[model samples]
Target: GGIPQVIARSYLAWWLGSPAWSPDGSRIAYGVYLEGSPDGDTVQIWTVNPDGTHPRLLVNLGECRAACAEGLAWSPDGSMLAFHSIRGVPAGTRAIYTVRADGSGLRRINRDGLQPSWSPDGSRLAFVRFPTPGGIPGEITHGELLTMASDGSDAIPVLEDVALSPNGLAWNPVG
Candidate 1:
């Protein structure tokens, strides 16, 4: 093989997002796009091993109008994963959700947040939130730095006017 050797494959027809590795480095998780059966184009979360084994479904977010299961981050303890999805919400809206690695306890934590990053202690999640409204397809909107508990409660905006469009987020390891 080449320098970048091939790894695992999801075996799904289409994959729509990046793959995230568990904190313990045991598994990789990603989102698969299911298109045009009875459900139209939907994105679902899936997991696989580093060596391309034991692929399985993690979170089944039915019918993400735009995108789903993006910016996945494993909790420090490797218990859950936080990601953004357009599932179960109005079109053009993205939300943060967490699901257990074992494919249980799927819950939406925030309504309009994306690219969730877990705090060092795994007690809270920091994500980018689109606070201001109205924009064209490529136009930039105001994004805020927000944090919430692991269970998706008590959301507080930490910083206002972070950037016009924030893609990913991370917490300071020493902070």
Candidate 2:
């Protein structure tokens, strides 16, 4: 009886990246890229109850021309989610965005950042920043480990002089 159950099923699109759980574990949030759409392809965020009910669209991040929205992280208090969107512009420019769980207050936080993980206290977020911008799509390149305030300010480099391209992030749970 230890097997997990499927909570939801998608019809026309495939999930784009990792899904994140709310701080209290009451819900799950994930992104999906629409497929076979006459309008066009776009990545959108959605959240659903664990029982596969009440699936709702949170935000529509348009036109993932080269890269898709990946890496979803919920704020410790469950107020917002921070994730990166790789837009069609600049070829490979990745940017971070945060949106309220209820689909309000969506804003782009940083450019050239990915894999945003929240600090244990939710006061800051750490992400990977690419150096010199513009790189080959879907290829790992040199980057730096950097952190910034939850409001997307006060960015500081935590490590440098090393070839790094982080694919995921998590804070020490104990805090």
Candidate 3:
């Protein structure tokens, strides 16, 4: 049973989104709203030592026009972080991206997907889509779930006609 407790809230910066712990448990990385956030033109990633001494800003998504970061994951090896964003590059598009845990070499991994979950081995990710380029919302249509490799190759349709939201899905950590 592994559950994390938010002992200290991210307060130095007001805009705090998803938070993921590094594999080594030395630091935590999360998305933060610099000044505008959610409605402003900027959102970014930041990290702080567990003792809360050395806080640092990792990646800024404001330039991409994304407003907020909602989901985040840490690579098993602690070398990288995978995160879901509503800002960056194309702007306003839901996507997945990764960057060094220390805030270096940020890159976009997926351009159009949502609800990113990393594989146990950290070599692949699972996500959901809106079936038909924006499938019927409200559970009115049947669209299967999808999966893809970490490099954005071999995007295979693993499920069929399940549901589509382009932003939501149901998955249990354990089955």
Candidate 4:
């Protein structure tokens, strides 16, 4: 491995996490949390060139009352990006959304899903679905693994009643 290099830095951001490389490796997409904004603390999605140049805001979550986005994934052809947003848009629970690489065509895919992983062919996505919190406080009973068309239709559970890590879904690159 080569020496690590810092490509992006931010003093205004509360934190930056979930960096995803575009399929062509030309750009990186990530989420940033900015505190003390006019809309209070908010999370936004951004993209930057691999060389740390031409950073651009892709999605602004400031409109959501209290939304944060993470778990970004790029479509195989680099035409779109998928991410999970908490309390976004419809503003209640976490959901999956996609947007064009140029930061347009924003759309929600699944009403409840997280950590989306695009299928090798980019025709489908696999994600985790944690059951809503219940019973004792701060206790989660289990989660399910699901796959659906990239358009968010025909979702079918692959595994249910299992402990699935929120960020554990990944498709086989070779498939």
Per TM-score, the best of the predicted structures is 2
Over 4 Å off in model 2, which ranges?
A: 132-140
Error of 3 at 133 (Å): 8.0
Model 2 is weakest, by summed lDDT over 10 consecutive residues, at: 132-141
TM-score of the candidate numbered 1? 0.85
Q: List the residue pairs that clash in candidate 2.
A: none
Clashes found in each candidate (C-alpha, N, C closer than 3 A): 0, 0, 10, 0
Highest lDDT model number: 4
Candidate 3 TM-score, true structure as reference = 0.71
- Tens-digit lDDT track of model 4 for 37-121: 7767777899998889999999887634433677899999999999987774444677889899999989999988888889999
lDDT of 2 by residue, 48-111 (tens): 8877788898998876764466789999999999988777566666888999999999899897
Count of backbone collisions within predicted model 3 = 10
Candidate 4 colliding pairs:
none
How many backbone collisions does model 1 have?
0
Candidate 4, TM-score vs. the true structure? Answer: 0.87
Candidate 3, residue 72: how far the Cα is off, in Å: 0.6
Q: List the residue pairs that clash in candidate 3.
A: 42-62, 64-88, 64-89, 66-87, 142-161, 143-161, 143-162, 144-159, 144-161, 144-162
Name the candidate, 1 or 4, with the larger TM-score value: 4
**How displaced is residue 167 in candidate 4, in Å?**
1.5
Model 3: worst 10 consecutive residues (lDDT sum) = 131-140
Against the hidden reference, what TM-scores do the models get? 0.85, 0.88, 0.71, 0.87
Better of 3 and 4 by lDDT: 4
Cα lDDT listed for each candidate: 0.76, 0.80, 0.65, 0.81
